[model samples]
Target: MARARICKPCLWTALLGIGFLFIWYFKVLALGYYWLSTTVNAAQWEGSSLWLPGYQVAVEARPIEGLTRNTSGLTFNNETGTLFTVINRPPQIAELTTDGRLLRVIELEGARDPEGITYVQGDTYVISDEHSDSMYWVRIGPDTRHVSIAARSSLGIRIDSVHNSSFEGVSWDSEQNRLFVVKEKLPLRVLVIKGLDVFSESRGFNIDISEWKSSSAASLFMSDLSSLTLHEPTGHLLLLSDESALVVEYAPDGQPIGMLPLWRGFNGLQRKVPQPEGLAVGPDSALYVLSEPNLFYRFERIQKPAVAAN
Candidate 1:
């Protein structure tokens, strides 16, 4: 009997094709994993049981011409009764009226990427730098128009350096005497800080930091934590995202109880918010948001109809 004839060229070609397929499959899997892990909306599919109430957009995205093009974080100052926002390009803070009119501008020194700001108490405020994991304690008064490097001091949280994963949002709970700082992803962690003497002149003080986690909570369908606002009356937090164009409300225990989409048609918006970088709740419980390239947004609650007499 004759031995079976073998085609060597065909065998080599088949083996090479199989090897290429194996490598291609792994490359696709690795890319999918990276995208899923980095995207915020991907986390929302992980099964959460919390219910969230949506909000109505009172004022859609409007343009402001006389301000910095890159607005990052927003904080409502009850003292001045005005909204404060920061610009990352020149590292300056600008005060704006409720109608998006620019009031004042104060340049900041010794800060890189000032992304988040929260009014702590009195004239003291907390500001976060995105590039550096540094939080600054700054005091602004009637006589103050600019924040020099000498007047600014780091709060010293001692977080490990991660590129662009630094603090992005900040909220102050005056009643609890705690500061809630939101990290801009990788895990989307909220840092609850207590016992950090923010109003002191000394640079040395101990801070107690704890991660806020909820058992049955709704996921924040946000790409990055751009800003946060603490609603005192409801004891809830409004978290802002730049990429996802969303604002998620979280209860005191970190449970997401409400949400408001910045995109059009979802929240009565005629146009979608381009880039929401900062958010704040005014004294009257009005939601104020700042978008990149100088845009302002306002959201108000919808009042239900009164019940008829029985």
Candidate 2:
């Protein structure tokens, strides 16, 4: 008889719980918060036209020819005028043109579970080994087709790192003379590696590892950080989140400024990017993104046309 009485409050509570789960699952709340934040902080963009959120998808879901899987982090090589990404499983490095064409796939040796790759300077690049929680400095020359891990410098800090979420992306801030490495999740982290001479041949090293946190960093709403790129010109740091389907830009002071959503309708994307793992910014401020299993996406700012002279 008691079963015949349906408590209205309990039913309403259950419905509310389900609604909340749906919103959370779809990232509606996170996106809303970010949207509100950006709107409220629009004044911060007064003079800067180099905003990340203003980018529109130039190339979407272009398959990297000859590669079928395991394409991760990305970095724009200023010297080569190309892009580089990592393949964790089977461990390899792939170089691509600015428009998503595969230039070459450099066979990587001695790196276990390479998930993130970033170009430091000249022929120097750093690759992050996810499983080992280590970063190795390697060189990739023009005629080079392979990168065998040498006795070069590396930094590994294992502090209760999870199985596969240790290191996800790496970016070199040339202006700051520091390297930024991001952990995938497990309370998503951004770290700054300084004083390590990436080009140093000697055995001695003065490395400093510190967590990068500020008012904005303390409130990063992304579920996971997949990759990161530093805009050396403006010193703006861009972070990519596969789960969030978003690319968020933060000022040098760590203030969140803008965002580019990887959803189907947002930023001229025909379809939501499946899995964005690598992020890079070219000299022209074009954004290059790599998704796992070898898909490439490029986003460029919608340039405003010049007005006629008065």
Backbone steric clashes in candidate 1, count: 0
Name the 10 consecutive residues with the lowest summed lDDT in model 2: 301-310
Candidate achieving the largest lDDT: 2
Q: Taking the candidates one at a time, how many backbone clashes does each contain? A: 0, 0
Error of 2 at 38 (Å): 0.9
User: Which digits, one per residue and each the tens of the lDDT, describe model 1 over residues 1-310?
Assistant: 9998899999999999999688556645643443444244424522221112334777667676678487888898887888888788888888888767888889888888888888887888888888777788888776677896555667755465578877888888887888989888775777889877777877776778898765343354455677777766556666787877777666576655446667678767888888888888776556788989798888755542121100
Across residues 126-203, which tens digit of lDDT does each residue of candidate 2 receive?
899988898888988998888887686788878659988788899988777899999888868999988878888666
TM-score of 2: 0.87
**Candidates' C-alpha lDDT:** 0.72, 0.82
lDDT of 2 at 236: 75
